[model samples]
Each structure stands twice: as structure tokens, then as C-alpha cells.
Target: MLKRIILILLVFSSSMAFSQNGENTWNTLSKVEIEKRFDETLNFEVDYPTFSEEVKKLNGKTIELKGWMIPLEELQGETYFVLSSLPFANCFFCGGAGPETVAEVFSKGKYRFTEKRITVRGKLEINAEDPMKLMYILHDAEIVD
Candidate 1:
């Protein structure tokens, strides 16, 4: 019983560290511009949204992103997670939002979740390949307020 109680307290504290009110928010969608490329020979081509010149310049630079924390797994101490524009039930993964609504977050350390919105600061890395990863990736991320 003691172990369970301790674990519960730790969970609550961790969640508080991550949760935030709706005071500060970052807009990532406008940073990129979507373009369509047509290749008649191939059935599919690169039609995904492309990052604008300004956004591309931000690559490998430290930046702060605001979004709701989405746990990749039920286990705690997850180093990598997802940040969504909406809540879990209405996030991009749930088909209620667009592709630009979610980003794969790779923090400097582990991150836990609360229902409140949160902000993260890290080095941004954009990937055009590797479907296993999200196009917008934040590396070396840390929670800020």
C-alpha cells in the first residue's frame, strides 16, 4: 500500500510539472506551406506540405512549442511522445484534426502527461523521410512552465 501511495503522489507531481493553462501557445501550422507535386509516371508523388523558408531556417535551432501532451504508451518515463493541437480524443491521431495538428516530441528527458495544455522547448528537426517518425520533431526538449 505504501508503494502504491508513493507512486500516486509522484504521478500527480509529474503531471503538475507538465500541465499549463491556456496563456501561452505556439502556432506551428503557419510555419509551413503545403504544395502539390504531380508526377504522371508515378501513381504518387510528394504532395505533403513543405516547410516555408523561415521555418526551414529554424531547423537544428532551439525553439519552444506549445501543445497538449500525448503519451505514446501507458508506461511512464517515456523519452519520446506526441504533442497534439487538440486533446487526445480530438487530436490528429484520432482523425479529428489535420496532419499539421500533431508533432513527435523527443525530449531531453522523459515526460509525463496531464489533461492540461503544456509547453516544450527543444531543438527542432524536420524529417521528410522515415514514416516511423513525425515530420515535425522536437529534440532535446524540456518542459518550460
Candidate 2:
């Protein structure tokens, strides 16, 4: 029947649309690649600007960033952690816990804080100014073993 055919077409179209939106477009770079780009070339004079530029270029794109998780005070029963580019002492928050000190990451499920080092694979989001205050600021974020 024409009705059955129309229903099938509608379902197919909807599924295709969902699939397109759900596509993962993040690119993964190896440690070697990161070193090649940042190691020797990164120094006191140009580190921050160069690093910021690279991250900016990957905005809205998926990237695997490896860093440490620094724990913050818990609210209610949920534990909050900060993903930092360096060790806890070097964290921007070490002095005053500034906005750039850490990134607020909420685990998908119940998780306990153990090691400070962790690697995260997620969509690169910028100017997330306050992850705790915003909803859905970062998408499809998961811990990488």
C-alpha cells in the first residue's frame, strides 16, 4: 500500500538524519605527533600562544587530550575533577584556582578518584568558561584508558 511505503520512507529518512548528526569527526594524533609539534618548538616565549592556536584550530572537532585529573571539593554526592594540561602544582588554579586552572568534568557514571593522571577523548570545546555552570558544554566526552 502507498501508506506503508510512505511510512517506511519516513523512518528511513529519519534514521539517516540521526546517523549523520551522530557521526564522529574527531581526529586522533599520536604522542609522536604531539611531541614533534610541541616539544622542542614550545618554550617560554611562544608556548602559550602556539598551544592556544592549535587548540583553537581544533574547536568543534574531536581530539584526544591527555592530562591529569585534579579533584575539587564535592557537592552533594557527586565528585568533580579538573583536567589539567600539566601537574597539579603547575595548574592555573594552584595560586588562586582561576578559571583557566581546571576543566569541570562530570563522569558519565559513578566513578572513584584514584590516580591523578588521566587521558580524555572528547569533542574539543573552547571558552567553556565555566563547565559547572553550563549544560552540555562539552559533548561525547569519555575517559581513554
Candidate 3:
């Protein structure tokens, strides 16, 4: 019937729309490729990232990512920390993983350190200019279930 065909088309269209919006994932963020370039100001070579079109599109957009928390300071009431795609022993700082595997997270709420993987939502910023910071920065982040 005509009504059945129309309903099927409507459902298909809605599912297509949902699929297009579901691209915010860690794999999409890992599309960035970096090359070491000499910085005249710092007088040293630093890794500079070249973000792919997919990763570039995520800049300034609120995205959700799941990662293990890397506490910078003490275990209690930490407002800022690093989130790594890998666990503690295999993280960027300790293991051989690249900078793309980590993100600097800045949150207003204090969080207790946990070894478990945590999901966070925030606006992602790609830091190409600041050598002192990580290549990926998450601003106004909050831990989510």
C-alpha cells in the first residue's frame, strides 16, 4: 500500500540522519597525523599534527569520548587531568603510544581518580600552536555515565 511505502521511507530517512550524526568517536579523532617540525621560538623540534578532514570537523564541537583518567596531581578533588585512550601502564606517558592517544581535560567539577574507563562530554579543541599543551584539548569537560 502507499501508506506502508511512505512509512518505510520515513524510517529509512531518519535512520540515515542518525547515522551521519553518530561519527563522534575515538577512531575519528585518531585520524590526525603528526610530523616533527622545528620550532624557531623553542629552538627544538616538536610534533605538529595535521588533522584529517574528519577530525578537523570535530573542532569546537561538543563530543563524547571514553578513556582512562590520568591524574596530574593528588587523588582527591582534581579539576584538571589527562585522559588517555589506553590504560595507565600503556598510556602515552609510560608506554610507546603517540600524543594522539591523550587529551588534556579541563573540567569545572572536581573528580576523584579512578582506574576505570570514564566517559566525558566536552568541546574539543585542537592545539597546534601551544607546544606546552597536548595536541588535543577538551574544554569544559564533565564525566558522564
Candidate 4:
């Protein structure tokens, strides 16, 4: 009975760890190389990010991210917004961080703007060729916390 109980506990712990795979996804996504590339349409050089192999492996996979909501249009209950590693005051647009510090979140439902940190889960899509779009985009995202 003691051995059986121990085995069950070990199995449960392992499963729990696996279920939290996205807990530190932001750290892995940070592994990127940025370079300036000239865009013919824009007539100027734009910063382009090349995702690392570790980051590419996460593409098309469901992951979770924790960050602050950034409203672009000052609209309430937005279905899409930017998620930043830092708060609005220290975010990328604020000139305190880089583009990689933020991800475009396209949620399934409208999310009210808040100063609190929130967690979201969705399938991550990497955009390397589009200069107009963010480097990281979370599709079908929903608030987890």
C-alpha cells in the first residue's frame, strides 16, 4: 500500500509539471536575433526579428503568457490588444523596452483594459516576414487568470 501510494503521488506531480509547460514561455520566446532590413514598400529599414530554433518549436503550440494589457485605441472591451512584459509605463511603446517584449493578443472574447497583470493561453504564431505585424501573435487567446 505504501509503494502504491508513492507511485501515484509521483505520477500526479509529473503530470502537474507538464501541464504548466507554458509557465515560463516568455523566457523561451525571448531568444531572438534582431536585424535591420530594408522594406521596398516602406522605403526605409525596419527592425526584423529572427526567432531562434527554441522559439520556432513553440509555433502553432498552445502556450500561456502573463503580462499587462495595452490598449492601442483607448477603446473599452477590446477583442484584441497588445500584451507587454512590463506595464504600460515601461512598455515597448514607452521606449523602455524592445518589440520582442510585447505580443499581439487576439482574444476570443472582449477584454476590459486593466492595470493588473493577467495570464492568457492560446496558440502562438510567429510572424517573421510581416513588418506590419508583431513578432509574436497569440491567436484565439483567452484569459486564464
Specify the highest-lDDT model's number.
4
lDDT of 1 by residue, 5-115 (tens): 999988644432221333222343446665556555565554466777766776787776666777556634687788876667877778556666677787777767666
Q: Report the CA-based lDDT of candidate 2 relative to the real structure.
A: 0.44
In order, the Cα lDDT scores of the candidates are 0.66, 0.44, 0.79, 0.81
**Candidate 1 clashing pairs, residues 3+ apart or interchain:** 108-141
Clashes of each: 1, 1, 0, 0
In candidate 1, which residue ranges exceed 4 Å CA deviation? 1-28, 31-47
lDDT of 2 by residue, 1-145 (tens): 9999999978533322111234322211111111112334333221121124444655676555455566554632243455654466665567433333344555454445544465555564554232224211234666766
Model 3: residues >4 Å from true position, as ranges? 1-24, 74-76
Reference-based TM-score of each model? 0.66, 0.47, 0.79, 0.81
Give the Cα-based TM-score of candidate 2 against the true structure. 0.47
lDDT of candidate 4 over 35-135, digit per residue (tens): 99899999999889989999899899988877888866675588888998767887888966788878898999998888777887888899999899999
**Per-residue accuracy of model 3 over 18-74 as CA lDDT, tens digit each:** 112565367777788889999999999999989999888889988877788876566
Error of 3 at 44 (Å): 2.9
RMSD values for the candidates in order, in angstroms, are: 10.2, 15.3, 9.3, 8.7
Candidate numbers sorted by TM-score from highest down: 4, 3, 1, 2
Worst 10-residue lDDT window for candidate 2 reads 27-36
RMSD of 4: 8.7
Cα displacement (angstroms), candidate 4, residue 11, comes to 32
User: Candidate 2: deviation at residue 102, Å?
Assistant: 3.6
